[model samples]
Target chain A: MEKSDEALMLQLQTGDLLSFDTLVKRWEKPLLNYCYRMVNDVALAEDLRQEVFLRIYRSTKTYRPTAQFSTWMYRIATNLCLDILAKQRRRKETPIDAYLESESDGFDERLIDPSGAPDAVVLKKEIKDRVRSALARLPENQRVVVTLRHYNDMKFHEIAEILECPISTVKSRMAAGLERLSKMLSEQE
Target chain B: MDCRFFREQIVSESYDQLDADAKKSLKAHLQTCRECEQFQVSLNETQQTLDQWEEVDSPIDIEALHDVIQPKPLSLPPQLPAWRWLAWGVAACLILTLSLSVLAWIGVDVKWADRGLTLRIGQESVPEITEQELVRLLQAERHATQVEIVKQLQGALDEFSKQLQVHLEERQKQADAQLVLIYQGLQSQRVQDLGFIRQELQHLAGATEAEFLETQRAFEFILASHVSEIQKNMK
Candidate 1:
């Protein structure tokens, strides 16, 4: 049987290096995707993801099993993202999509449309770009709420814990974010 | 029964956050309220639209993280492979035997019958000296000196590599520590920013509270006065 995260964590705390490897393998992709959407930059997201695991490895000795391992992991990852976003805010940098087009060719090529029709392929690409742009335009809190809700499939309470906010606030942000996204998608269509 | 309550439930129900009681109420309301029913349809459509945008699944480069979690180096010196050491010892023995044979061939009395080297020169013994024996001794001394020099160089190289690795690790740790410090500072600043916003909202709420009540009272008085004036004019 696969070990539980808590079990792996316990093993890691006892200095079993393999447990750390196992944990990293299990979480690296999901955490990378989470950070990508959070920061909207692939390279920055990977850096943040690495930082998340580095922090986890360092803290394993003091890690408490009181909460689910995912909760703690998300808290660390989201906080790192928020810090990056805050710094961007201070710098007054433009949104990622502004320059994303220059880099989009390399990335979007990976997401190939299975259908061979040129029209369908183009349509899919347009919708994908629109969704990303709309998501990028959302305020940070709402963007995070929707991303956690849809992409991570985290529970409202879990998201609340990660964001250090109330469940109602999470739901509120989700509602507003969804409504805006729906409107944006419709307009694009 | 009200559309407002049902509207709130629509979004929550879509998220699977609605309680059974609230869900039942919303379902009943949906059966009668065309507007809210349309809203439900739109919300579901929105969700479907979102579902179309699949998340990009990119692999993480884990080598960076792996470096941090990797175990420290063992302190013991690396030993040469047993086979290689055995080969070196055999070659050295062969060289020593070859030199002894050369001494015997050169007409000097040489004995190496397991008690180690012994030699005689010109039958006077000459303190047990032979020219080939002297040459053999010199060659053996040179080989041993070369081996010692190689070993010392190898040790120095190992030490240099270890120190380089340690310095690289120290630099990485320092960079990580600096990043963490910056992250903490940003987090605190975010908290302060939130607190400041909350305080401003509270202040706005206080300032608006009396104005809201006073406006309500004034509006009611105006309606009453207007109604009486209309009645008088009608009479």
Candidate 2:
């Protein structure tokens, strides 16, 4: 049975180590998907996924049940990934050591994104990657608002709270980011 | 609503967050306007296409994470009192400024060269000195005294920063008990009596040495004045 995010978090705060392990299992895939899309590096995304959980551990004392647990957890992850990206801007973005379709991914094309013999899905992912690459090139705030909204399916109010922006502002940024992405996608097409 | 108004509304509408009136108006507009309806379709398709971006899950090596965490009890630094942490941080920075000054006095050129490094210094060298020649002779006797006095000050400041880092680690270690005490004090303080918001600003200031020192003094001065004011108010 699926537990409510709040309940899982309550269990987590009480030092139920198994709750944390379960939370990690529950969230690891979605969080990785979100992070991997944002960062475009498998290992860094994995590393960041761990950092997100570790941060959850560190911030357990401060965690409140006022918001959904996924919101709280992803907010921390998004912010950390954004910070990593901002720092990385001074040098490089790709983990140069891990980009050659990592050998750890054995020779199964389905493994890359699990496209079940659908070329459209594969192409769509390529387009997604291109759009993401373009997004990383945009200003940080724009990238985050778009990621939180379009990718995470967060409502404008939730995104505003996460970003601490007015709803109008989040809308403006998402619109602007999507506009830019439309241009980039058109160019790629 | 004008087309522009409805157009702007469409983006949020696409998010499924629009109110009933606005949603009704937009739906009506889409029914009447071919352009908007086609635009809505394209937007919908784009979102569906974005589904491909979701990451395929990866297998985790729990043993690796357990390896990192199992070594000891959690190694997180104990949180400190704002005033004490600020004080030690400033004191540490001042001490750093003095140490970097010393390393400067030890010399920047030869010491750097001996460490198998290179620096682009005196870009437009004097008439007698080519940068290449100076770099080559940096280790020689002629430039042995090349350690400039001003540079010595910088080395001392860097040394201070290094030492301060050590002190901060020790301070964090030593504060374990004191933090427990202060945590108790805060816990005991009536919530209405005091309110605090902790700010962790990693981007304290500019990266340059001179800028860093100025930033340190400014923060220290700000906190010191604020603390004194708080004490006065309490009295």
Candidate 3:
């Protein structure tokens, strides 16, 4: 079994650069997926994921092992996404998807299941696209909660900690998000 | 559990989020209620669809990350030539001696006595070109220096007082602005709350009116039916 992420972070805290590499390798993809879903842009997601690791390394000296590694990491990533959204709001930029749609060079292919037969692959791709599109349509608050719950498989209490909201609020948001997602998917059908 | 309770628990139950007791109750209710069972099926389907949306294999550049985390090799300072080293040494010695000489000139006596080199203030009074002229010049310079110092202090005091006043005014303005903002926020919140309360009251009143009208219509219909029944019986 691999060393746990907290252990790796502890090693990093002790100035073990190799352990930092190990952490980046482990967290980069999930963080990338999270950023992509949050921002709905491939290039921006990749950039934000890179920044998340950089910030983690920068803060390793002050990092305490009080919280779980995943919680800390997710909180960092979540803050970065929120910061980017705030900047976008300030600049009054076009919607991320509007740009993404124009640059649509198979951005959704990141979720493709490669081992399936051609027809099965196509159908799977369609389902993934529909689900993702519906996810994209949710308000940012609902989107973040739903994605954390579903994509990251975080518990409601963990999400509450990350969001700094009450567990009831997280549950209500999740239910509301899921209900809206249900309606959106049904409409697509 | 009633259908409403089961409906509320459906999402949690489907995701195994409910406690064992709640789960048991919800499951028992599910067995009895067709609508809730259908809701559970749909919620599970929604969760499965969400699960199917997996992340793709997008490779991160580990090399780039290495560049960020890798420790940089330490570089040694370049070796100086002998003459350059000599120059630096001479410069450092000169600066030290210059500072020492200036200190000695400032009334500290430096001497080579019988025992060794000694440093002291030997004379209580120094002979100038003219003692009177020197005394007058010294007194004049001292008075000028004192006046300049007093002026500088007063200027600093005035500037500081102005700055303090400005700072206090700014702080007071900020506090007042914050108070106004808070008051406005509370006012708007009160308006929103009142609006919501009024809407709820209106909705309740409408419902009560509808119920009263419906009851009155039902009473009238009953009276008409009873009269017709009696008339037919008497006939």
Judged by lDDT, which candidate is best?
1
What TM-score does structure 1 among the candidates reach?
A: 0.59
Name the regions of candidate 2 deviating beyond 4 angstroms.
A92-131, B1-5, B28-38, B70-235
Top candidate, metric DockQ: 1
What share of the reference contacts is kept in model 3? 0.51
Q: Which stretches in model 3 have alpha-carbon errors above 4 Å?
A: A109-118, B1-8, B31-35, B69-235
All candidates: CA RMSD (Å): 41.7, 38.4, 36.8
10 residues in a row with least lDDT, candidate 1 chain B:
B59-68
lDDT of candidate model 2 versus the reference: 0.72
TM-score to native of every candidate shown: 0.59, 0.53, 0.58
Error of 1 at A19 (Å): 1.6
Give the per-residue lDDT digits (tens) of candidate 3, residues B52-136.
7768556788887777656568899999899999999999999989987896778787778999988786466755578888899
Model 3 chain A: worst 10 consecutive residues (lDDT sum):
A102-111
**Candidate 1: CAPRI quality band:** acceptable
Alpha-carbon deviation at A67 in model 2, angstroms: 2.1
The stretch of ten residues in a row with the least summed lDDT in candidate 3 chain B is B1-10
DockQ of 3: 0.29
Q: Residue B214: error of model 2 in Å?
A: 99
Q: What are the per-model numbers of colliding residue pairs?
A: 0, 32, 1
Worst 10 residues of 2 chain B by lDDT: B196-205
